[model samples]
Target: MLDAMIDDDHTAVRASTQDGTYPRPQLLRSAWTDLCGTWSFAYDDADEGIASGWSSAGVSERDIVVPFPPESSASGVGDTGMHRVVWYSRDLTTADLAGAGHAAGRRLLLNFGAVDYRCDVWVDGQLAGSHEGGHTPFALDITGSAREGARIVVRAEDDPLDISQPRGKQDWREHPHAIWYHRTTGIWQPVWLESVPAVHITALRWTADPRAGIVTADIELSVRPTTGTEATISLSFDGRELAAVSAVATDRETTVVIPIAELRNGQSYEELLWSPENPRLLDAEVRVGDDVVYSYLGIRTAHVARGRFWLNDRPYYVRSVLNQGYWPESHLAAPSAEALRDEAELIRSLGFNATRVHQKFEDPRFLLAADQLGLLVWGEAPGTYTFTPTAIERTTREWLEVVRRDMSHPSIVTWVPLNESWGVQHIAADPRMQHFARSLVSLTKALDPTRPVVSNDGWEQVDTDVVAIHDYEWRPDVVRQRYATDADIRRLIDSVGPAGRALILSGDVSEAPVMLTEFGGISFDTSAADGAWGYSSATSPDDFAERFEGLMAAVHASEALAGFCYTQLADTLQETNGLVTDERTPKIPVDRIRAAIVGHHAN
Candidate 1:
């Protein structure tokens, strides 16, 4: 039989006003508990009904850890290829749910931080629920299904290369090389249980309009009891009470708008705003009868007008890095909260104001850290290289998941659905792809019009708020020919006229921001090939440094370029062209890169 691994000791929940608190619903802790660390795991080829009878098949010979999927080393089941389905079974006692103020009879909710592709939950051998999207969190209310000491079994099946789902950066073909890695299957994040009242707030979404000096809040309830109830939504900015509005909550959504001027001590104009440099957050409290939900919101506004991106109605340059959020040990999941925080801090230390989460949707801890640290985030859906209708639906579903799960984070400034036309073939001509991109953009705008949405990051620019491009002039000759002479660079900029391309680069050049979404990828190796120095690899450290300096010089000199993100933050497997190594260790010391970008090294 598979050896059962014990769960981690629950950390004491402490409330802090400064940092260390997740920017989620206040009742999140008491309502949900993290089920991270070991559980009995097994794999089988039998039908789904046989999940409960793992012992009968003699499949208990080896154990796989829970939360961390079998493919990840962190899960203690390293590199299980895509040939088999993985099963995770664990026994949960009532004692496991005991803690400060937690009582019995509350609904026992099993929350999966994330399970790839598809997953099903079985309680006491009864199917409880199932989820489709792999990158978003899902929960099963295993209340009555659990006996006194019932065994809860979770079965997850992921066909990483199935070409029917949204598999971002995952190449399932044998040994993945170049821009792809091993497929992450089953539970790859924390799996835990939480107890909540039958009638409780399901989720909370906050949208801030810094220009209007108002914040609109939508509080959703899980269960709708007969007869509507009057709920109070309170807003506080920097400890000062903002507004307390009463709204009726039925079986549907409840919204309350609070003006910034009414909640602040002074006029709305006097209130502080949230930005990349200084992210100021306001505390919030929601109450339905005695049940209270707590959360925070940052006062910031993001928009694209003319041809520029604005933060709080001012032109702001979004210098950023492409963060893939992959680790050697954890794969998709970060090893710990500190690991997430370290990445944010490292990115900030590099003098960049933002980070574009390249392909994958990161864990909530990463988003929490970004919120607290005041970093701007461009969240993107995981892309599939190939195109299909099933893939399109999967992408749309995952995109919805991203917006719903990450809507409240103030750090998230933009939503990118399609990147580099990975799955979008013939974007302009293909009605389906165009419709999908336009729908996603509209959905993003309707959901949170406070921020801009990029329908497609590069190539065929659609009706997005911004015209973004990813130009990797990897070859030195291309770089020299484009920018070596001032006249050539000027001509290039002029060709992209003021209203370049219709917001096709044709938007107001002065107002609408033109972003070189991806550029400056110079790779360096101690023992490098002779010709690899130019386009793909740098011969020596000096060559890499020189190329980086030159790229930044041209970027700083260009007035048309509102912002640019260095090709990547770190190298991934064979993609050695990154500012930092795969392990997140800086390849070209942080100070040196910062000096070239932000210090005296100029155009």
Candidate 2:
């Protein structure tokens, strides 16, 4: 929100919707203000600004765009250099709080989409609220603090070298290298104010079933559901009510599944098949007493059975791409919600039905776009390379936050707690790491038993529903030579033979649905640079196309592989291996890439 120009090294273009529109599109209200544009910012190198009364004394004379962290070029302060602490202060004028139904008399909820690492908020020099975890959203009720003109100050701190914190794709160096990009230091998401009733709905979750035509919506009321209050939910399509139900209770949480089957029988809705080919969504509205929320649910049934992935109770192929969720300008943040929507639709247009969202708890708006676009997603956490008590604590707390926020989305079919052998690397020999891996799986299951949980993806997959592997065998025959039969796929490849020693690091068994979860990182860019390149670099575009086709053909011919996820959707930072370039331009012909992936030639 830095005025007409944001400080960055790019084209110096402007972004749209820099404001108080609701970030949580899944649960939306019309009354809110966008406080995203500009604010007073200063770098706190000594990290002593808090004790120095920066909150009351006011920030430095520099203007910065809120939510676009200082490290990002789009933030208008492209200082990739580490700043242990940064301060942001905004003057909350009466005009900024003039959203409908949220004027003077209402309790103003100050919402932040995200703030990296640890953050403390102050309203007029008084402690308002604070939140831990970089990816999760938080809100504070600022009723009395909403004067005509008040100073709202936020201080955030992040240390990438501190392995305990979940930094995700944000780099740890002056310049991004390899898989990591520039570190997102402070506020990297939207900040806004909303007016809500004293007793309102706090959270809403939807558990949908496409096969049975039933949607169970769970409502968490801000206060205890009083006897005089009622919670009503309606499922509608094109404004025609398909099913309606209401509940009167006294509990804080109430759950009820509304059957939207045909009037004759309580079975599936044949016309409402939700797939990448035909994305269909059921519009849902919920009202708790006087508080109303507009939301929608995707009713696609996703599960795993018989060593196969099932969609809507039928065997389905997971044509997925590995998406790192980084952009050239915003780093971890998307330029706009429209950019997220366009990215989802673009991936779908390229013929990918699913995506393995790599190493990031992606923006909820992107997931909502996937829910609408019918793209299956494998939700994965950003990998942590070190194992310690601090790491485990942070992982547990933040992982649950991730699950609780996204568990209701029907598009998320699988939850990957860890990637490869990242944090728990010595799992094969380290008992503690093995136990922790198993515990992560158990913790994920305890929260939401609906989706399959992959504890440690790639090699050391201990206690997971999917036996996933990350093998980059360049040749087609070499790939076939490795995984040829069900025995080869199911064999406990650990603590035994050469193949076992090579492939398996810790898992006790591999008797699960086999998915070549990661492979085909063929880099087509021969540009001379110092970027972090891919596994196998391609010489020419024609050679890259041929190699891709041959490798995909090998994967398709293998009956043992339940599914495969291409290395990436687009190039990022130092890595230049993708079906499309970093700018989303197809490296190979889009149709040709699709043909290779689907095992068919384009017409």
Candidate 3:
């Protein structure tokens, strides 16, 4: 595509805000306004816009499509240059959300899905709040700031020199390199306004156990309610209530465990088991006084046992793909929610059970689609490549926040805090690095003990529930010889350090479930493209198929190996190794690739 055709790729982009879909499916509310669409924007090149009183200024001549960042053409401001700071302003009114009606008894709050780096928000000329971290959700109570007509201004700062921010695959250089793409500044996700009762449910957590016939829910309120405020919880399937209970809101948090199995009257129901074949979710509703929220949870279990991934106490093989979560027009921002749903469908159609969201913290809407569509995910943290105390502090804080934000999603099965030693490269030799890796594992387990935590995904093997590796050895014989047996896996890991590669040595690889986390990046450039490369280049389409099939078969035949993750699902800037092109067209029919990988499905 030519530079003149940038808008050609942006056609039919998903307007997430206007789509009326619940941004957070786990917690749904009926009253909200989509603060998306056109907004006034300007660049703060010297970081002097605030000093120049830009926040109080009227809309500028420049208009940027909101939600999409400046780096994306979809935003109408495709400036990929070094942007350290930027400003956005928009207008809203109380009447936009029923000013004196339902909102009169409620508090108006401003919510941001995500903002890259650091951002300060202003509402009606008053400071609302500020948030750090580019990959988590944050909100500000703007009830006091809302008026008949209100002005919202946002000041976002992204320093390429700041090594503390966890920016995944966002190149800090003047231009993109190798696998890195352009950087995103300001809001890369949907911004909206929500109205809630004065005392409402602030958060909800669900943990479902199929074998135990139990599902536990933890509810956090905005405040400790007085005597009259009580929370009523109900569970149902297909709108038929199975259980209902009420608890007084004396404290800010409440825990409720419902016995889902009791509905069967001591009978085993095979359909209750959730899996990729049959993804079932139970409907739940929470009501606190005038506040009502709806959510859902899939009844299932995920664990690692006997050196294999066990789902519902059965061995589950993960045929995953590395989804970088980029777009031709939007870059880091998704074009639409339906587009994300379509992408998930494409991945599932290729017979992949899981996706490793490599480096980037993928949009939550995609995870919501995964939960509804039955695709597993390995949630990873994006971090600075260089190691420092600042990087350590930033990664720890943001990673914990990410876990807190995403732990409710039933699709995510693993928590990968670091990938391929980007931030903590010296973890193999340095004692402090080793301790941090262990601490990350502990922190992940302490918060979300349900999911398996891989200390470092690709090469390093230090205190991890899953021992995964990134081997691009295209030769089938070498892959078979290297990981054919438990003994061979250990030898290959021990040989990694002496061979001048980075592999931290601590726990034995033989004790944990082994997976070829990354492999088979068969580059097939139809355009005979310049700078398009992968682990190996295929001379022809036939060659690509044979090479891909050979590599996949060798790994699948390895009885000692639990699973494998393909290099990628779709190609990104200059990387022609995906199963599909950057335009999202298939390089080869997915049926052929699925047959090559898994041979047959349940059908």
Candidate 4:
């Protein structure tokens, strides 16, 4: 474990020997320890670990990486089978606890970035806490349970074949097929520990309004502070101080509003607004007593108006790529913090201003990179296959958690709750499914009204601000004919979509902003995969380059389209239709692909 600090600029100022990236990028503290690396692991095939008191003892039979699931090769236990019950244990000494920082008045908290399905945490043979939902993060306070020779243990249970669960791309089949891959059963993200004051901020959210020239922060504390306890929030840009505001806390929650005088006093607000071209971020420092948390926010606003996607009150074209966020060795977990940063840079290098994080809630570190690199994100969740009471309960619970966990990121401009009608397959005809989709949109908007909410991203749209469609038609002429004019786009919206389903379930959205959200999945690589397939296939690199350029030309020439998202950024398992290989090697020249994507290629 290594300790790090957040500099005055709200960037991580790490020790020279620090190897891991900070887990929580938005909220930063000076004293924290990375609890990643090796941990004693075991498989409870017979479900006997809990009954046998495994949580109170060590499972030293096998060693597994802390954040990577046992299913991934990076975990050092490349077993992709159905291990519903998995146990992890690690030992920590008093000296190890002291490594976090001064410990006299501070309480120790254990945090997990994410764990699949459900898990329970135990510290020093006592149940510290438990959490559900695989893709969202949670923390547990172990102040009273920590001592010398502290033993930390975890128990995770996930049913791989449960179609009712939001499994995402994790295939339930014996082998990878179609678009599904292997399962990620247990702890597949970073775990860490930090020392915090008895009364500390538990959550922080920043909202930026460039038009209003103000930024608001909502702070949640561990407990209500005493009288006269004040919270100070300071904002700065490029190391120059902007505004500092203070508030007296009367409850566990408080709000601070800092109005930027420069934006209102004739200063060029364009220089401060966040966009793909200029990802201007305002650094902030929040202090309450001895608790200080550093954070940052991008001043921007995104919405849909007059049949166009608008950023900072101006129409902005969304050139996006569908990102699965999977790696060959690490599965859902990124190989390293540097890898997450590189992934964002890779997407930007392909001339995409945005990325639709397909079917998974990505790492916060990746979102941080997007914020810094000026990439817009469409936050989506894994959809369950079946539509049942259990499925609805699980999906709703988890989707809300995902939105709440990620809505603060300025890079994220949209919230996609359902995609291609996975859980609500009969949404077009079933009123219940339609209602479910609509309710998700309403709930998401209730939590966050700053961004648009796509009720169903691909098709079968129940209620969506963006008219998103998925068309794999490879012919450039036909693609041109489909969206050549506003009338053609309206007719297509009222008709059956490319997936052979109604584009809209009940709404009259002929005037909403239209986007080709999924298209051009042209498979060009077959060297690594035996039965690799895509929506369309090309024989060679030149063929691929031509096909890609043609499809993109039609999309870029559309008079009715507000944006487009190519499917996808890279290949995954049997789905080899990617601009780049699974390892992120561009099949065609990077410049050639970028030219086509940006509409600068010489057709």
Name the TM-score of candidate 1.
0.88
Candidate 3 TM-score over all chains jointly: 0.93
Q: Report the C-alpha lDDT of model 2 over 52-76, residue by residue, as the tens digit.
A: 8997766975989877878777788
Which residue pairs show backbone clashes in model 2? 1-37, 1-65, 7-76, 19-34, 20-33, 20-34, 532-574
Clashes of each: 20, 7, 2, 0
Better of 2 and 3 by lDDT: 3
Task: For residues 27-59, write the lDDT of model 3, one tens digit per residue.
Answer: 766566777789999888888887788776634
lDDT of each: 0.69, 0.77, 0.80, 0.86
Task: Please write out the lDDT profile of model 4 over residues 40-101, one tens digit for every residue.
Answer: 99999999987898989968889998799899999999998888989999988666687667
Rank candidates, lDDT, best first: 4, 3, 2, 1
Count clashing residue pairs in model 4.
Answer: 0
Report the error of model 3 at residue 124, Å. 1.4
lDDT of 1 at 478: 61
RMSD of each predicted structure: 5.6, 6.0, 5.9, 2.6
Order of the predicted models by TM-score, top scorer first? 4, 3, 2, 1
Candidate 1 structure quality by residue, lDDT tens digits, 85-167: 76777666656656312466567777777888797777776778999888988778877854455677777788755866777
Strongest candidate by lDDT: 4
Candidate 1 off by > 4 Å: 1-27, 46-52, 55-59, 100-105, 146-148, 262-271, 475-511, 526-535, 599-603
* TM-scores for all predictions: 0.88, 0.92, 0.93, 0.96
